[model samples]
Target: MRHKQVAYVLLRITIGVVFLFYGIGKFTMGRAVLVDGLVQQFAKTPLPPGLVRAFGNVIPFAEVILGFCVLFGVFTTMALALMGILLIALTFGMVLVPNPSIVANNLIYCVIVFLLLYLAEYNTFSLERLWKK
Candidate 1:
């Protein structure tokens, strides 16, 4: 194997593990609480109440699925793209709400997501690799 392949594997493993852990954390903490908190947070914005609730309910599951895909190195590009988009939206939400704490948290996560994207070509170690075999 090449040095680039080694780097790819290492980055893919690290990013995959992190995403999986984050997704598990969301589920472990109780989805309803997470949903309610999101709803309340969004309620402060001009976004429709019903839409907020609906999105709140949907996000957790999406996170879990996306995390799983990343963890397993399946559909890596699509999974990373979706996660990136979600993080960007989250950053926007924090900005809109002007919550210092949330802004800090979202910013950190956004950076992580961006880093993952920056390293995405390294995901050649994933299913995409096997497919090429």
Candidate 2:
């Protein structure tokens, strides 16, 4: 494989593992705890409790599913797009809470996902590539 393809694969797998562990950690810690923590964290913010709760509930599942998709390069473009959307939502929530650090970190993730999407042509070592042949 070319250097660019190798680099892209490394980045994709690294981000995927990060997200996979993040989601798994949330589940292991209990989703209810995460929901409660989110509700408490956003209590003083302008965000609605119901929305926070719902997002908290869905985030873990989304992370795990998208993480696997990105890791395996299955529908890589779509997975990256969805990951971008998810990061946007997380960033919005952090912004509402005035958590600058997390917002900054999330923005970095957003940029990475954007790059992955934009350079998707280099994704030659993925399951999607194999399936096409």
Candidate 3:
């Protein structure tokens, strides 16, 4: 295989595994707990409580979808962009909460997502081969 092909395969695998774990975590452990916390936090912000809860529920599905797309190398660029944006938003929220520990994780994930976005062209290894033709 070519260097580009190797890079593409690596990128796809890395992104897929990361997102798959994230989606599973979101659905199984983080969503409800984080949503309640977020509802409380957003209660102090300008955002409505209902909207906050709704966003919390929707975000997990979004992550799952994006993760699946990355795993399959489908719409690689768009999925990376979406993941990057979500990471950025998460980092921002962590900062606003003034939680140093959470902020650290968020920042790290944001950087990782950005790196993945930077390498999105190499995510051409999977089913997206048809899309390339």
Candidate 4:
């Protein structure tokens, strides 16, 4: 029980910090530069150009918000669910590019996020607990 709790918090914090790094870099890069990078990534995919554009715009912002939520353990279930969906979308993007490392990394993140969601009740150290008082 103690070990699982430790693993859950550790994974959540680790993934959150990684996402924060990725998300913050996008903001510093600016929209045009970031979207240009995203465009290059979506180049091989058959997804509609507009849809790809939309995702490129939204993903970074979503990551920043969701990453913070997970890191602070606030509304963790909702945050974890979004993280899972993001990972799924990212997995597809990675597979399209056939980038094995990103795909594996996204999969690993999804698994940890999902497992944490399942055992979220055991998360005693979360800021979420403060709401109960």
Candidate 5:
């Protein structure tokens, strides 16, 4: 494979695996832990109690689905876009955390996701490509 193919595969797989593990970690760590983490954020925001709870519940499963989609390179563009949006939201929330490095890392991830979207046409090792051909 050429450099483009290798780059595409590497980015896709890395994004997928990172999210997949994060999603699974929610389950392994238990729901109360996740909810408590979200609770702290909720206290800082104007969001209603019910909506915050719902969001906390929805996030893990959503990450799993998004991860699967990216891993298979099916709807890669959409997956990258969604991931970008998520990173943006996470970056905003990182302000509540004490770790500055994680915020910086999230910013870097956001940039990488955007770059992949900008090069979406060159992602030749994708299920999208196979379907088109």
Candidate 6:
């Protein structure tokens, strides 16, 4: 039982780190660059440029906030749900762009988020759990 909890915690932290760093990297690269890159990538797709830009504008902040929440086990389930939603949106866009590689990778992320959601009840080591006690 303890090992299962530990495994869940490790997976949560690992996913959090990946999202946190990816978001940080985007900011480091400059928001305009990131948004522009996204715009260009989805340019030929049916997705509207404005919609893509709006999503891009929020992606970094959402990733950072959600990543922190998951990392520290604060509202872990809710954070994971939001993460799943984000991944779904990303996957949708990738499919429109027909980028098989990224869509595949995003699907993997979706699986991880789903696993995290399932293990949320075992999140006894989280800050929220500790605080509740």
| Candidate models: Cα lDDT each | 0.74, 0.93, 0.76, 0.84, 0.79, 0.92
lDDT for model 5, on a 0 to 1 scale? 0.79
CA shift at 24, candidate 5, in angstroms?
A: 1.4
The full ranking of all candidates by TM-score, starting with the best, is 2, 6, 4, 5, 1, 3
- Give the winner by TM-score: 2
Best by lDDT: 2
Which residue pairs come into collision in candidate 2? none
- At residue 62, what lDDT does model 2 achieve? 93
Worst 10 residues of 2 by lDDT: 14-23
Error of 2 at 61 (Å): 0.2
Name every residue pair that clashes in candidate 1. Answer: none
Of 1 and 6, the candidate ahead on TM-score is 6
**Which portions of model 2 show Cα errors greater than 4 Å?**
none
Task: Estimate, for each residue in 67-120, the C-alpha lDDT of model 6 and write its tens digit.
Answer: 999999998888999999999999999899899999999999999999989877
Local accuracy of candidate 5 as per-residue lDDT tens digits, 1-133: 7888798789888888888789889978987789787877668666666766777787788778778888889888888888888777667656654458989998888877888888877788877788999
What RMSD does each model have against the real structure?
Answer: 2.5, 0.7, 2.7, 1.7, 2.1, 1.0
The TM-score that candidate 2 achieves is 0.98
Candidate 5 wrongly placed segments (more than 4 Å): 41-49, 96-99
Question: What's the candidate order when arranged by decreasing lDDT?
Answer: 2, 6, 4, 5, 3, 1
lDDT of 4 by residue, 1-133 (tens): 4887788788888878878778888888897788887788788788766777888899889889999988888888898899899999989988987899989888888888888888887787778877866
**For candidate 6, which ten residues in a row score worst on lDDT?**
117-126
Q: For model 4, where is the 10-residue window of minimal lDDT?
A: 124-133
Candidate 4: the clashing residue pairs are none
